[model samples]
Target: MEVFIRHQDKNKRKEEAVNFFIEHKTNSYISHSEIMSGRAKSTTEWSENFADILSAELDEDDCNLITIEDIHNKIIGIAILRIYRKYLIIEDMIVDGSLRGMSLGKKLMDFIHNFAAEQKIKALFLESGINNDKAHSFFEKNGFEKVSVTYIKTLSE
Candidate 1:
């Protein structure tokens, strides 16, 4: 299937993007730190606030909200990227759950790679939930290395 990746026009596509995100949020996870800090107790809670967060990011200069669409112009994937001095961080990335096995995710990653290369960014970084082995495998297959492990300890208040 042919798909195109582009920077999302928030004014025109925010709602569609949010809806698509909500639909696929189940495939994502809330980090242990988020849960321990009460920022979000679950993926559902985290995703419930996605619309507002996405809106804020859309207005940020260093944040890029990208969307991948099919030939029919339907949003099939979304990614939020934050550009830093030497690295581009993928804050969130989701491809339509129904279409998982397809090469769409790789296409999105390729787009990100080119975008970073064009901007002369040195590296790309992202984190996935510890238990998300499938996502880990996918990232590895797409040339991402397991660079670091994040450990969280809930402090007593």
Candidate 2:
């Protein structure tokens, strides 16, 4: 199977890609009780807000959203990125569940690395959930280091 990666337009197709990512991301938390519990407490508002933010990010000059499509033009992966003055950040990445072991994530990361090098970016950064062991392993294998811990607190009004 041949796969091609390109910048995706902010359209219905992009929305589908976002939804696909959200589904997989959410499912990944089923084994992590704390995160899944928080997710289940949220209403549709969370998804709506996330979509708005993702759309806004796509409109920023320093941010990009790329879709990986199969030969038949079906979007099988999505990558969201932001390039800053000194570094590039991968905000989100997801591949079709069935294609996990096929090196698609490596392909996407390589694309980011090359693009950053072209832009003279000095470093790359990303945040993976603490409970996402699979993602952590993948990032480590791709040369990412565990630099910082992100702590979150839930506040209620």
Candidate 3:
């Protein structure tokens, strides 16, 4: 399938991209039991909050929302890159779960790399959830190294 990668048109595509992502959201490859044991807020509230945060990032001057589309103009993937003092951080990236084995992700990474080069960024950074082995492998294969482990503690209010 022919794919086009470009800066996301916030007005035209943000909502569609967000919906697609929420539908396919994963626990980063965690086991079923682990996922079941985890503390998750009401799905409705979580999704609402996520959408708001994502929208805000898209509106930020230092963030670029990149999207990939099929020839039919359907959005297949979305990525948000935030510029920082030392590197370009990939805040979020999601590809349609139905298109898993396809090379759309590699294409998106190549696009990001090229964009970073153009902006003279010396390094790129991102974090994959602790249990997301598929994501870990993909990132490793794409030349990302395991530099640190992020710890998380869910607090109850």
Candidate 4:
């Protein structure tokens, strides 16, 4: 399939990209706070909040919402990137669940790498959920290294 990668047009594509994120987030593990608050009980409940955060990020100067689309103009993959002076952080990346194992994810990563290089950025960074082995393997295959482990402790309410 012929696919094109480009920066998302916030006005035209924010909703579609947010919907894609909601659908594919099933692969992600719920956070401790979400579990404690019972917001993880249903995808429908927290999706609105998730949508709001994602939409706002798309409008930020440092955040770049990159999207990949098929020839038919359907969005197939997305990456939420935060660019810094010396490095770029990929906050989130998702490829259509139905299209897994198709290397679309690799295409998006390659695009990010090229963009970073053009800006003279020296490194790329991202964190994946500890339980998402599939994503860890994919990141390794794409040349990402495990630089550090993130530990979080939820404070009592």
Candidate 5:
């Protein structure tokens, strides 16, 4: 499969990415029980707000939105990076579960690294679900070391 990695900050693209993320959240990794468990925090509303904020931030040069399109020109993966005072964080990383293992994920990652080097970013940090072993393995295979364990507890549950 041929994939093209693109670095662009367009609203249409950002919305496409956000929609894809929310679509996955609704079905794949999250169950209804888990969704209800986080209702007190209004996780869904917060996520919607976040996507809006992120979409609005696309115009900033320090924020980036990246996507990978297959030969058909359909976006199969997307990632977003944000630069802060001390670190460059990959805030979003998703490859359509159907399209995993075709190296597109790694290609997008490489693009981020090259872009970061140009931006003179020194350190990088990323967060991923410890439940997603495939994602963890991919990051580990790409030279990301275990930084620290993150714990999450829900008060409403």
Candidate 6:
């Protein structure tokens, strides 16, 4: 499979991107209560909520899209980025669950690094839950060091 990195129009690809993240959050969420308790919560972010946050913080020029398109023009993976306050953050990344172990994620990250380089970006940042070991490892292998930790405590049930 071949991955294509292009600037996807929000109006055109909103649903596809939404579905991808929603699936990621759902499929990869921490299932066991022992794990989801304490400081480790499931990485379950709804797509509509993400879309609202993105739309609020990012202008049209501040966002980008990367998709893995095969010969049939089907998207096997998707990655989103946001450039804000002189930092580039990988807002989300999700490959179709069935397409895992196929290196599509690598292709997507490569495209992201290349995009940053082209823009002469100095640094990049992303937030991944502890449950997402694969994603955290992927980012580390891609040269992202965890500079700080993001802490969250549930306030209500």
Against the reference, the lDDT scores of all candidates come to 0.79, 0.71, 0.75, 0.78, 0.69, 0.66
List model 1 lDDT by residue over 13-74, tens digit each: 87788788767765345565435444364534564465666566567777688999999999
lDDT of 6 by residue, 95-138 (tens): 87787888888888888888888887878888765577887787
- Total colliding residue pairs, candidate 1: 0
Query: How many Å off is the CA of 109 in candidate 2?
Result: 1.0
**Least accurate stretch of 10 residues (summed lDDT) in model 6?**
31-40
Q: Where is model 2 poorest over a 10-residue stretch in terms of lDDT?
A: 39-48
Residue 29 error, candidate 6, Å: 5.6
lDDT order, best first, reads: 1, 4, 3, 2, 5, 6
Cα-based RMSD of the predictions, in order?
2.6, 4.6, 4.9, 3.6, 4.9, 5.4
Q: Is candidate 1 or candidate 4 better by lDDT?
A: 1
How many pairs of residues collide in each model? Answer: 0, 0, 1, 0, 0, 0
| Candidate 2 segments whose C-alpha is farther than 4 A from its true place | 27-48
Deviation of model 5 at 13, angstroms: 1.8
Q: What residue runs in model 6 are displaced by over 4 Å at the alpha carbon? A: 27-61
lDDT agreement of model 3 with the native? 0.75
Task: At residue 94, give the lDDT of candidate 3.
Answer: 84
TM-score of each: 0.85, 0.80, 0.84, 0.86, 0.75, 0.74
Candidate 2 lDDT score relative to the true structure: 0.71
- Model 5 alpha-carbon drift over 4 Å, by segment: 26-62
What would the C-alpha RMSD of candidate 2 be, to one decimal place?
4.6
Better of 2 and 4 by TM-score: 4
- Residues 1-157, candidate 2: write the lDDT tens digits: 6799887775556677766766666534322222333433332213335555555556677668888888988888888888777888887788887898898888888888888898899999887655678888999999999897755565795
Tens digit per residue, CA lDDT, model 3, 1-157: 7999999767778788777666767755332222233322432123336666556656768878889899998888988898897689987788998898899999999999999999899899987667678888999999999997644454686
Q: What shift in Å separates residue 15 of candidate 2 from its native position after superposition?
A: 2.6
**Clash-forming residue pairs, model 2:** none
